[model samples]
Target: MSDILFTRTDERLGEFAVRPVRPAEDTALLHGWLTHPKSAFWLMQEATPEQVEREFREIAAAPSRAAFIGLHRGRPAFLVERYDPAEDLAQVHRSEPGDVGMHFLVAPTDTPLHGFTRAVIGTVMELLFADPWVRRVVVEPDVRNRAVHVLNEAVGFRALRTVSLPGKDALLSTCTRAQFAAAAGHAPEGSAAERGANR
Candidate 1:
């Protein structure tokens, strides 16, 4: 088992844990998740085990990109990533000193549960703030993803602008630790220095 990043145990829902990705062991399941119709934004129609391994290996090799697997009751249930926004979007958005880019994919569950996706999104935001130098979490989700738009707002990210990427126009959004704390109804975790005193 890997180190746990975040977890919660509620009588109704059982335990949920978030940790780094192990694509070698999880390639098949992840492939299914990424190719599902609901995951169209993923843009990978079909991927072999070798392809998945290579991609994840490259992610692990790049210091600027990091991926994690989220577990619900000790089972892999979601995938999320964080990268230097400047690096990920350098071809488009000009690099900025403190921008961190992030994305998430929630696995399709056989048993649907209300608010599960929201909790997963909350955990991702919390993880981003875990770093001391992350001044802002930047996201460029497709403007058409209205469901995720609501989720982003629930976590205190406000729309900054609409920007066009290589293939799709996205709604750029950002959230700082203070904004997140207010939305989540809890003080930011870890050191306040991590949040920095910046707009």
Candidate 2:
């Protein structure tokens, strides 16, 4: 069986999994998604499968960056990545010690799966919070992606500001572990009831 990163079923959602990208096996699918109009932000309009493989291999070989393929019930469905903004695309953004840059692209589907995209975002947040080193998660989605704007808000990501990047103007957003816990149907770490009315 393939290695999986996450496998949980929330009552409001369905089972999902995340795995590191296998460039050699997934390049064609990535090429198609990156070339599609909906994925214009990815900026690989003319990319061929070979180019996709080459690019993804380079990403996998990078030291401060990591990529993953998200699967919904064992089928590939999206690509996600995380990196250090200070050394990656936004070296001049004046990053802090806890800042991490993130990017995600949901693969086009034959039939749309309701709430699946939101679930993907939630799962990504869950992954981030799972790591104690990550106190905050940051994203630089294109300023024009209104759909993602709303979804991010639903997950407690507050807009920080708009900044210019290599290919587009990005609306910077952030989400902390506390914010995610609240959005994911959990209470804050400390509370009167949970602490049994202690001081």
Candidate 3:
């Protein structure tokens, strides 16, 4: 079976695609992305390849959670995680029927494109909402990470409050499909927002 799980296009960014993460096949790539200096917020900068693989393997084995590798124009460009909020975030954010917790990390690059990160996040949101059962997307990003906060708001996420997670203080936020569509539509194409980083 082909591994691709979702595909979407950005008017200016060509094609963006996603596939189930293969721990063995993607270890090297994920390790590099997770350890890059830019990925400081990912909290695994010192993680070994084995540690990274083990993490993905755990995600792969979880029925309530799944991880995917995101592609830009068919090349891997980011990482995505989707989980049922009821099972994963109930302690922090009360469970809701259609809530899905999300996290994404863009691969660090020597050449960062203007507006590229925003497009990546926007596409990720689109991918999640395409599932009719998913009513909203939730995130708990480090409160100190201002860059991601700007990017999150740029795409329509409303900050609910800060909460204590296992390792850090996270800003709990959410965005609905209507909110995303409104934000995406109000913009003048791709140039109207700030970029994003990982959780």
Candidate 4:
């Protein structure tokens, strides 16, 4: 598709692709995912379709920010947001130069595959690192989200500290290219500077 910007193939899984999100076309689908019980961590369990659309629309129009749909084997399976942390997490975390903020959520599925979420996150890291200027990937996930905390650690995110945001306490974490290489048990892919590239 014209919007597809990045692609990766997991050794065990199939292909993972990322494309700019089309707010109008994805409203209904995104609404379903945002309201699912498994997505409670996203703080939009009661979101209406209109709310979902509006939120994505705002994200789409924001400068230095973008929303992408992650596709697995050509089917939309997840959501990813890339942004400048200096503005998004400005009040909470002190962002360094070349830092990029990221958020990812896997769509709830009844037919779940083993290690699917991990693979998706890994691929996402690879996708981010693909850009040469991305020196570090930054994330501020809710502190109570233990599952995501574990995943962050698995991907080499070292928690800097817990900080209070507008509505929740968050664990500010970061991962560099060297750190990710160590965690992924592989050498650096390409000239990875960290905010990241496909593995």
- The C-alpha TM-scores of every prediction are 0.86, 0.87, 0.91, 0.92
- By summed lDDT, the worst window of 10 consecutive residues in model 2 runs over 190-199
Instruction: Flag clash pairs in model 3.
Output: none
Listed per model in order, the count of residue pairs whose N, CA or C atoms clash below 3 Å is 0, 0, 0, 8
**Distance (Å) between predicted and true CA of 89, model 4?**
1.2
In model 3, which runs have C-alpha deviations exceeding 4 angstroms?
186-199
Q: lDDT, candidate 2, residue 43?
A: 82
Worst 10 residues of 4 by lDDT: 190-199
Give the Cα-based TM-score of candidate 1 against the true structure. 0.86
lDDT of 3 by residue, 38-80 (tens): 9988899999999999999988788788888888988999999
Give model 3 RMSD, 1 decimal: 5.7
lDDT of 3: 0.83
Candidate 1 lDDT over residue span 23-116, tens digit each = 6887888788887888888777676767877787778778778788878888888898888877677666665666788989999867878888
What does the lDDT come to for candidate 4?
0.85
Best by TM-score: 4
Any residue pairs clashing in model 1, and if so which?
A: none
Off by over 4 Å in 4: 187-199
Q: What is the lDDT of residue 6 in candidate 4?
A: 78
Quantify all predictions' global Cα lDDT against the true fold: 0.76, 0.75, 0.83, 0.85
